[model samples]
Target: MKPKTPRISAVDLFCGVGGLTHGLVRSGVDVRAGIDLDPSCRYPYEANNSAVFVERDVNEVTPAEIKSYVGGRKGYSLLAGCAPCQPFSTYSQSGRSKKRGLDWQLVSKFGELVSQVQPDLVTMENVPQLQDHEVFEQFLGNLHGYSVSASVVECIKIGVPQSRKRLVVIASKLGALEIEAVGKKGNSVRTVRQEIADLPPIAAGEKHADDPLHAASSLSEVNMKRIRASKPGGTWRDWDPELLAACHRKTTGATYPSVYGRMEWDAPAPTITTQCFGYGNGRFGHPEQDRAISLREAAMLQTFPRDYKFLADDETVTFSRLGRLIGNAVPVRLGEVIGEILVEHVRKAEKGTLRPISEELSGRLF
Candidate 1:
């Protein structure tokens, strides 16, 4: 008879609405707890996963505190952190300083906790642009004792219904590690229609009577006219001349064509951002609707489960808060891929079939 596989446990930092935790749990990892600075995340994170939520900033969390949650587990320990990406995002590049910024420092802090706790596995997800920063190098340096591999993964390749890209890093102290490739273009790619077309329709400035969370924000008279003229796969260029914003007429703003656009039903969505509920932000307008994609639709594009609840019965939904939580989450599909990779690595190691870094470097590890 085969021996039972040893259980793997995890502690998620900056867990944010528990997207990573949800995916990991689905992939068979026993996630004990999640740590985050946002109190708003407590409800959703705790509600959806088996883990407890610790509402504390990553910077303020000590190794002892982290150990309290993960220490008693009997098997492999994993630490996962998806630090905020805004500091290294292309949109914020011009203003970022060489000196460590707050978000960058959070990545460094993640390294600190990893060094102290010395978990069997470590994984991090962040903007692809973070690969260019010095802090990333330092974080890599801190993992010298472990075998590490990283890649910039496209979200759509991993079954997410959006064209988002993220930098993913995985390291293992037990043996060499390799993350499976995802986001291959072909019949496997998920589309906007497949992700959200089934929802009962709701008009602009309205909420579904049965599901209040399936609500869209109100649009002003002028903006409503602009959305009416927008086309799927087309930009503001399709709008009537009078409906164009003044900034769009200028040469500088002419480059920002994705704003005031609509998603193509047959293709993946543009990257969902914190402002996705606004018609003027990216190509967030529903393909056939007269308003921006609803908050529920935005979460769906991020690969969150359709019934994933962000608010409670008595809690009022606010566009800004929920939008940020949803957009900032790691796509649950990508998290599953990560969890699968780690589990595979451990399985191979136990069976004595795992390849060393030197042998696997050329074939895997981007």
Candidate 2:
């Protein structure tokens, strides 16, 4: 008898714009459905992978719904849950009042779904800060019978073009299983200027009507003037004496200089933020162009393929939403690395040669 081929199946939770879903699909996994609360995700999620997207909050998702999507499919059932991690980010830790502390409950809530679905495999991608949360530890403890692995990983080491760090966890219910070590860093890191320099130039706070995704956000006249005066890798100090904000002149202002600078064309872009399209936000200004990175450029730095379509309409989408979607995503390249890791594990399992990580990363990204 011929040996069986692995039938891949996955369900993405908190699927913001389907970045993970797209990567899994690229690696030959059949993504059953993407579950999230935003109705806006439905179009892109469905359009890109043809996977149905549930516009329901994860708190309300039931096992029956998951079962219906799986439908007795005889393949690996991967429940990849990437709960929102803004509450655990370092940015949240320093300012904005700790009143919005990490919501530790989401992990346990996700655990409830895992207990119900009892998938062959489970994975989660989140901010590195989450690794220290008690709630995160509890979520790992809940996986009693499975081999669990969690690590604070550098996304660039995994081939993501940007510098983003995430905590990744992989667990298997069938038996002890762990993700393989990431290989040594790839040849040359992809830089911010290299990725988006080819696009047609657009001015600050302007939109490119041709390709909706290529549109640059319109800056306020004041901010636009600031961007024009901004130097690559230089901050507010570069501004003319009169142009300097009152905040910058204050005693507490020196520390915020990374906020309003342009990216260096030869280096990787600054980590994308929810406000990346704004020139005054996070060194997001273009190197030579007097504008922040465009929507397409932001997504590209997230490692989404250039042609990855986010919409099916001619109507324009706002930069705020675009920034949120791109910034929140696990780089699709990083997702592919996870998918490839899963693929290798599956392959090894078939050959009876699989091995588990020994207490996660000890040194290096590998």
Q: Which candidate number maximizes lDDT? A: 1
Report lDDT (Cα) of residue 223, candidate 2: 84
Looking at model 1, residue 365 earns an lDDT score of: 40
Q: Each model's number of backbone clashes?
A: 1, 3
Error of 2 at 105 (Å): 2.5
The whole-model lDDT of each prediction reads: 0.85, 0.76
Q: Taking the tens digit of each residue's C-alpha lDDT, what string does model 2 give over 238-331?
A: 8898888888999899989988799888877878777888776688888998778888889998888888888778646777777787788778
TM-score of each: 0.94, 0.90
Which regions of candidate 2 are displaced past 4 Å? 1-5, 90-103, 174-181, 184-187, 355-365
- lDDT per residue for candidate 1 within 1-366, as digits (tens), equals 964555888999999999999998888888999999999999999888999999898888988887887787777889997988777665445556753387888899999889989898999999988898898999998887788888887777668889888899999888666443332223378999999999988889998887777889999999989888888999888877999899998999988999889999999999988888888878889999888889999988888898998998889889989988988898888888788777777877888876675555533343
Cα misplacement distance, residue 227 of candidate 1 (Å): 1.2
